[model samples]
Target: MDISAEKLKQLRLERGLSQDLLAKQSGLSLRTIQRLEQAGGGSPESLLALSASLNVSPQALRHSSVPTISHWSFAQRSVQLSALLLLLALLLALVSLASHGQFSIYLDLVSLLFLLLFVPGVTLVAAGPMGLIMSIINLSLLWQHATGSLAERRFLQQLYQLQYRLCYGSALVLSLLGLVSVFYHSPHLSTASLQGALGVLCLGWLYAACAAELLLRPVLFKLNVSIQAEQHTLAN
Candidate 1:
């Protein structure tokens, strides 16, 4: 059966078992262990063996790790749907704006991709490769344990915290660079030069604001709500 590779890796890590050790403990081959963790395909017997070794139920290794839509309250579902629709609306609006037939200095496919990549790229450069890698690992761990552990909730909070910081930081960096360029070339700055520098400044802030408001914030809200609801249920 198809299982959750993330969940499997999480369980193994939580138990402090290396792949080689886990294979020996589970009586499965090392290659099988790697394959299961990478692509999540194994028989029922393999699942049972891994579960026994990991001290979790076989179902826990399956793909039903996260809370599903059916488990959410009506209000939660409505909020999620609204968030999704809002994203779609924002996307359509962007498409409409770009398709207005008038030439734009910045509204094109290349610029869109650059805007999307720039924040994370700059963040990685600023935070260092190792920091970004660890953050990603924490994010993956957060995905499965968000509602199950307080530590994971802390990570969830940190997730959005990092999101906004990167967004604003990138925007501010670009704006400052733009201003520096404008000042450096002040004596010879033509209309096109002024517009180009200002475009960098404006696009930086615009993309950052849109990403925070339309994408990251909504996702963080949903996860926070789900975590709170799960905690409330456990408390009661």
Candidate 2:
């Protein structure tokens, strides 16, 4: 009630509850509760849960007033972005293996389909609901490419809008050229070509990861909404 995370956490412990249990009772994710108790970004539902689980009144929570930040910082975002990068690297490695022996016409078609679908699918999973808007298209392009429905124009348009679009483009074009060279001229999976392409893709991925980490970070708190009433002293 004093706007101290330790106080709230203390109350939870006194009630013989773990953070996870407290979060469950309050209809919050464990992560959200952790953030709230850590004095970080979390859903407003945390306040509601505190009131319900602790049997405290809303007024008690509101009594301290909410803290406000004019800007979000990078202290916590780096952690999450590192996770994203790890996931991307894992997916790339898996895709390269899966699409290995499937480079013939029909194999290429199937492999492409798998790449297009699987990559995004895993990303969507790893990123969860939050990454939908920003990452959906990138995943989709890879999906379409795998299915052999790859459209160069769509990629061009999509690339134009991304923040690191040029970097991605540079990387993508080089990969494409490498892939074409390896596929048409050689038979087996092109290790050199794949590595080169992966290099470029990695660059693009880094660009995206950095951008995500630095931009639109979550910092939930309160806003100051003030009202002013004007008085009229006309012939009263």
Residue-by-residue lDDT tens digits, candidate 1, 60-163:
88886444545555755565577668779777877777788533644544334555677667657766776566445544422232344656555556656676
Determine the C-alpha RMSD for candidate 1 after optimal superposition of all C-alphas: 13.3
- List candidate 2 segments past 4 Å from native: 1-3, 40-42, 62-236
**Among these predicted structures, which one has the highest TM-score?**
1
Residue 6's C-alpha lDDT in candidate 1?
A: 92
- TM-score on alpha carbons, each prediction: 0.52, 0.27
Deviation in angstroms for 146 in model 2?
57
Give the clashing residue pairs of candidate 2, or none: 112-146, 112-147, 113-146, 113-147, 116-142, 116-143
